[model samples]
Target: MADVLSLKQSILIYLERSGGLERLAEDCEPYNDPQRTEAVYRFNVSVHPSDVMEVDPELGDCLLHDPLTATTLFQSACFQVIKSLSLIGKLQTESQVNVILNYTHLPPFPEYTLDLCRFPRVHRPVRPVSMEGLVIAITRVTKYTQGARFLCTNDDCPSAGGFHHIRVHTPGATESAVVRNDFSCTNCRSPLTEDVKFRVLGGEIISGQQRTSTSESHCFVFLTRTDELCNSMRIGRRYRLLGIPAHVHKWPNIACSVEANRVQPWNKVSASFQRLLRETSSSLWRFSAVVAHCFGLHVAPPGSYNTLKLSLLLSLMQTTTDAEDTFHNVDLLVVTTDTLIVDRFKGSET
Candidate 1:
């Protein structure tokens, strides 16, 4: 007889077998470095069979199930694994963000989804307030550029806080900002006293279109990520991010960026540096071929590569700029060395 268990239980067993439950909990601890830690994220998967036996008798494989058929049941199982940790007071569910998975016809999948409940729920909305835009720029956060920080210095009471003097070290002179003289908490008359355990970011998010016309109008959205909800984001990509209405620094009436809670890529962009190098190389190879066939022979403007190379060489060697005619002149890489040591690379093509 085979042992039977709920899908969630089976998933937990698999996690235990894989030695991930405890490891994942430790990674989400407060003291852990956010950069080094692997974020707990979720994506959805569909469970179904890919059958094509009727198409061709020879190409039938109905007996074997589609290896990548993921169902919502799998998502429930995965969610239970993390939720158990959170219930046990081991994992902080604040940083973990659940996202919708992008479905594809791959043989295997890596992520599954079971999102949490939020104030303005991200998955499906009871209302229709949302912001969708491309991340045009991202700025690094620092200690000095925080939204707001407080100080209190009362050791006796539990709510007592310490004295806070906003001082930033300048280049020439080391001076402090306006110091607060409050000794008690504003809410209660208790002495001001508290420790700074949590970290809040003051980074800026510039999200909008790069190019637009007068007829085709587009508004630029300036966002600020003050809370810990905003994760590490990439630029030049579209995102369906969630945010609440927020005001600018000096202008209270003007609504700039909202406090971003969650961000998901609406449009995927290539993130590979090697891919870019390959594209540049491909263009250069095409250029090499085009110049060779067209300008080199010059017979019927065979527009041989010889002519192109000669033009480049002359433009490079003749460093004079024609202000009246050409206006702009090309400058080639100059070998500014007194000695030419013969090595293996002297005549070798890179």
Candidate 2:
């Protein structure tokens, strides 16, 4: 209990020093009115592990090893700060307020980032980890119970009337497992009954795979924010995923899965190539012709097939930048009876 209190105090001090308390108070202003009917008041707080480390090294280490406990401490600290500021007007219950700690920036730890091939061998369960690979598959949107309120079944129990028992969804826990009805109350030793009205629902689950140059591994990724992330992901595209690795129990076997915290689009191009392209783009007049000449040099002489090469280059450019300019769309189709030259062209590197 002392350690928990110390951690909570450290979190509170970090929030105050980082100006998170002010942000929390401002975010809670909307629900300050007693007439508000919203059942849940969510406070989204962005946390930087480096910043936390600057304040308290032990707390920062705790945040990395035991993220769930750190998050709960952050929530408790935010609730205390908000209550002290009188921002939580009539919202006095634990079920009414939720604090979401978004770890936007993580410290540069070697264990935090792992290659797809090294993930299985090096990953620590329940700790934050990052992996980069192509997205091969995605699942449809599904409903999940984020949190549920349970009441003691015994009417004579002191905790029967209040929303005393609460179960929250955790990493590696299934939806059915969180809201399971066969729970015994601590006070009266009676079975708990779930109150459906107090149940909180979250967005969706996404599954994908991770691949490296040497090896490929099947990875199951779950994302909580569906509407924001689902539209941006495409099956053949590569992405960098920051999540927690866990062993999920299936019927017959336990499968390894990742609870994704953040999804980032991965760029395959090298920095030097990008820099060269940027430098070349500065000279707009001769850029297209130069690019086309270089693009077809591997397949044929630069000056021999200038027109065809230019057309192909223009089509590729248009396809890549189609989202930026919808009006100036160009499509190219090459027609020829020579199969040998076409085969050679197909074999050339892009």
Candidate 3:
């Protein structure tokens, strides 16, 4: 009698099962649960009569079918999951619901709604600013433009839009003239002009000249280390970069307590000078070793092939020898927050 009663109850369940009675459920974490290390991403799924074929053999045999009822049942199950989690203080926001729906990889049905309170806000990372190389050249005044001349920096003005202009006063000279031209853009050669004009940009001199202008337009564009910012610019000179309102000047041989020490040779025995030279030598050796190692590593793999080669090269160069530090030539690599300009004399044997 008990077996007969169980069979009757099973028969009633078979008629109510969706499709063929295969049950499926989605397992997603609720938002702001704080129980998980990371937020849960979501997805979507679709159900149909064809999708049901497991769990109940009787339902399969009977072929129960009802699309509308099946959809309602599926929606109820999903919402129940969400509501249960919400009541448990797990469902964080409406956005999380949307995430789960979309993550199932199915188009959202009209019955679905999203929760937004569950997710944390995202922020972007910040970056540091940097400058590029420059080369300044002082060209002779054009014949057509009397009392005017061009101080051409190594940078092509047309290529880099407008060039850097600096104003300077000669000790015994009067006012001069200047002129400029726009060149091609550095990247796209679309007849480029300055996207944004830099009015007060300044730099030290690497090379320059002192000459008379034939034209009225005397222009100085400090684009390179070898540029003359003054009317009487010269080679083997240094300058201070300053910009005050509309006036910009590249003052030459402007001494500061910081860099003034490097200008003179140490004829007297000073500990500071001795230490500076020693530090400079050691730095040069390290730079050379680093460069050589980098080059060797590029040729082959480090452990089996390039390793032996790099080791051999280092031995041959005597990079480990403290005595060999004297042979190394180390130029100063000056860096600043705003620029990476290197000051090297043009045609100098040193």
Best by TM-score: 2
Please provide the root mean square deviation of candidate 1 (C-alpha atoms, Å). Answer: 17.1
Tens-place lDDT per residue, model 1, 1-350, is 11223433544554465454565455335424444332234333221112222322221221112111222333345456656556223323322333221222212221111112222222331111235555666555433323123444534543343223222211111112212234455545654422333212234443442222233433444354433423445566565544333333324432233444355555443656346545557575554455344543433355434655656645655343232465454543323354354343355443
Which candidate should be chosen as best, given lDDT against the real structure? 2
List TM-scores for all candidates, in order: 0.31, 0.69, 0.15
What is the C-alpha lDDT profile of model 2 across 41-160, one tens digit per residue?
A: 666677788888887888888888788777688777776776777887766656555666667666566778655455365246567777777877777777777777788889999768
Alpha-carbon lDDT, every model? 0.37, 0.69, 0.29
Q: Give residue 242's lDDT in candidate 1 (0 to 100).
A: 43
lDDT of 3 by residue, 1-350 (tens): 12433333443343236321222222443433566522122323222212233434332222222222232333334444556545324433332222101011112331121111112111111111111112135445322111111223334453332222222221112223212345433344434332222221223332222212232322233322111222334333333221101112345531110100001111234786466566657575553444344554554543444444545565564233232255664333323464423334433434
- The lowest-lDDT stretch of 10 consecutive residues in candidate 1 is 166-175
Can you tell me which runs of candidate 1 are displaced by over 4 Å?
1-128, 137-156, 161-183, 186-216, 224-235, 249-255, 268-350
Comparing 1 with 3 on TM-score, the higher-scoring candidate is 1
Tell how far residue 102 is off in model 2, in angstroms: 2.0
| True lDDT of residue 64, candidate 1 | 19
